[model samples]
Target: MRQKTQRRWRILRRIDAESRALAETLGIHPVSACVLLNRNLTEPAALQHFLNPSLESLHDPYLMKDMDKAVARLRQAIDGQERVMIHGDYDVDGVAATAMMVRMLSALGVDVTHHIPHRVDEGYGVSAEGIRQAAANGVKLVVTVDCGISAYEEALLARELGLDLIITDHHQPPPAFESQIAYFGAAVAVLNPNRPDCGYPFKGLCGCGVAYKLATALVENLGHPGNALQRAYLDLTALATIADIVPLRDENRAIAQFGLERLSDTKKPGLKALMGVCGIAGKRLSSYHVGFVLGPRLNAAGRLDTAETALNLLLTRDDSEAGRLADALNQLNRERQEEESSTLQDAELMIESGADALGGDILLDSDKALVLASEDWHMGVVGIVASRLAERYVRPTILITMGEDEGKGSGRSIRAFDLKKGLDGCADYLVGYGGHAQAAGLTVTRGQLSQFRARFLQVADEQLGADDLIPVVDIDCELGPRDLTFELVNELRRFEPYGHENPGPVFAIRGAKLLDQCTVGANGKHLKLRVGFWEASYDALWWRKGDNFGRFSRHQLLDLCFSLDINEYQGIPSMQFVVKDVQPS
Candidate 1:
């Protein structure tokens, strides 16, 4: 029987000989060495650093471009006792950055107020209204985190209002078509690795990571102990680093590595309460917990309510207050999930009813992309829905909420397509747009939506090839049931803090006999399988693959691609196979 969805398996070329040599020298398993080699960590020093990251491995904070200027301005503000305002975005990175800045400044005995813009009302970045409010409050200096590089008008507005502006962001600078040097407009200092003039060695720091660097520099210049601050705040940096979806390599890997260790003992009342609410308290934290468990709860306030709720939670000192705020965020996350599910259903319906519909299978359509809009959809969750649609249909997707005169929306794209460039090509139909290559947001007048949709689809069709539509699973190596041992799985744990550019290694297994299969989970949304190879049997869990349970029978031979992990139950730990894909042998 054929599977409902098609997947492409691209097995990585094995470096078995190199792995054996490296393993002997490094005192590790060949499989672990192979995974490291696959990630291009061939050098001994790089491998050792990756295996055991340390705080000393972090780069100097002053190495970034504009560091001196930003530090000087902040020092002046602190020395003069000027009222400073930290303007932040509404996402997790923004929330974490805002919290870090507020705490860092407060520790220096400087008066700092923060403003997190409402997602619906203020959109993103530094807004003129936010600046005007800061001015009205007699703010002398304004610092932005996670946003502001593209705030050309807002930066000018700060100048007009006689307020100094410092932008600490990780987003790419505004595109410069004609000039060789990137223009950051009129900010006092722009601290961003993506800036053309920036000499930061690692360009993948998240917004909070940049904020952490700024805070570190400020603390050192103030004659305060810097190590204590870094240790105290790395949990926030790690949370933002994972949540921002930035590549986890170089400095980012070190931050995440140290941050995960710090998270289990985080002193923040808010983080403790959040972990408790998420049922992750007292456990060894990882990037997975930050990205999937904690990140969404922090993001819920920004998505469903005002971001200030989340920012306040992080800034609060009272334990009871933290508990209350955590509860509120938990409830909001539930609401967000419901809204996302509903919106996704509506999007699927639209695809099925549209001209490009194909036999009830969204992925079997001729359309290069899916652009959907609904006045009834919630604006906050459209981005997540767009991502879900893009993954399911294997095409770039945009979901919009139509307003009276304008349509606001977000988009998600596959690897072969660059959404930012696609939007650039259709700039005429858009009122405004901003974001990265894989995701973006746009606004257009209702009258221009049809044209924007058509233009976007045209761009995707021109750029995407047939192979681009098929999802590719890159297998690190082929393995057998006999190799699935607790020791090997434990060694794989060195690749902790996996995300973005560094994912958990996937392995392929050939000709395994299906010993047993059954549906599990609350709604039978998952599958539990027993497979045997040679004389060894293993337990496998297939998430969201329960619909295919009937396709396999006892003694059926199958090929599988999976990742290895340790699953614990009733005080017992054992190796578990997480199935990625399966096919008949």
Candidate 2:
């Protein structure tokens, strides 16, 4: 189902002579310059870098707080021929990070094994049981990827078990201590850019990026000094970076651009097999391919079961094993989709059904944030459902699967609200919680469900105002029939592989007369309309908006916000407006 929430259009462009001057100086379209200015890239050098972020310009790995310590510890482990375990979470980011570490460490002659904690049994982060088991297995060094920032107790457990730990994580660290030490000084080193004391210039790195940084530093510390080795793993870094939904700014842009290039011709059988299964085998990859097409499949293993399948797909050299793992991940993703759809339906019914499903006589609209739960809901699918509800309702939403004594839930919040901070405010009611500002996972005892709900709503109320609850569709600029051209669309295409922090440009046009309209696609699931401003009539495709066919009529003046695209048919290419939002003018 699609979200029904109407969005407020926020036009970001204004008359700016600087953008015009920049366009003239840079020999590019003024619209592109305006978009770059919107991202605060004014200087020519900065604009150039933004347009083409290169791997050669990556920040020094040693700039991170404990990169040296982490590298030195890993070097010691290698010298001693000690067994090292790469601890990872079950998600794509963690699995990618783990895969990179295993490859890098194995190449350096280290006896490397990896552990991906079971979602149900071990939950998340550096597991205490995992640490003890690693010790029992004669693993002398434990290195965590994509997790362990919040593993204070687990860090202590590793220390008690006489194991040296090097933590590489990207999650927001807890409130600072006096020393600014990483992970409560339980391990040898923690390499996280988010550590308050870490002076790493780019803090937008996802967990896999951090792991790549550590790998770079470690390899540079040893005989290999250049980035040839680092470039080899860009495929994994890019995959995890896009999958993790981190900002695509600074080095991340370079990592993604270069990594996507490498992924197109990846040497790894596992990635190739995964891509083949995703039906993107020979295509030049982009963030969309990774984020939407491949990411969910890789994430499915972690969500439905363990991340072993996904991790194996990244690590396996055998084409047969890679194909098997890819197929397994694809099957798991289908199951995950079914679970997510069912849970979303259940939650939507609960929201619309009113007082009986939701709490009290108050309707859902009365609360600033939703906290919906069901015993029948699968824990793995709640996060996906929460994201859907948050998008649909235009507010923060938490979906919990009730257990006998406790409930495990996930919360996805609007950009205006910080979910992690809100969970911090309700820490007293939660057993544990950790994640970024927009998404978080939590465990709450069954007894405190109502209290937690009330507290979370209070937090949302305190942070979000009436305006914040309404979603905003940012319009890069306005365009008329004359302004929409093949040239403009071609220039906008420069910002390919757009994602977080760097979204594709959305343009709006006002008072376009709807000449004709019809439904398209299976079950009439899409809208195909012809709208004109003056002498120019353009076709518009509103994906999944066929249900809105009744909203407007022929000859009606309508306002449309859309992104430009060139639709190619056979041997010819024609301009197509991919509509995002539409309303009667």
Q: If scored against the real structure, what TM-score would every candidate get? A: 0.96, 0.95
Model 1 ranges with Cα > 4 A deviation: 1-4, 177-185, 355-364
Over 4 Å off, model 2: 1-5, 176-183, 355-362, 533-536
What does candidate 1's lDDT look like per residue over 1-585, in tens digits? 122357888878565787899989988888888788888998868877888887888889889988999999999998899999999999999999999999989888889998988888888788788999999999999999999877777887898889999999988775751152223446778899888877888899999999999999988898878788878798889989989999888889988888888888999999999999999999999888988899998998999889988898888999999999999999999999999988888777777666321122223367788888888888999999999888887889888888889978899999989899889999989998988999998998988877887788788889998888888889998876667888988888878889988899999989989999999997899999999877778889999888888888889999999999888899898777899999898
State the lDDT of candidate 2 residue by residue for 229-333, as single tens digits.
756799999999999989988899999888999889999999999899889999878788998899999999989888898999999999999999999999999
Q: What global local distance difference test value does model 2 have?
A: 0.87
Judge candidate 2 at residue 457 and give its lDDT. Answer: 81
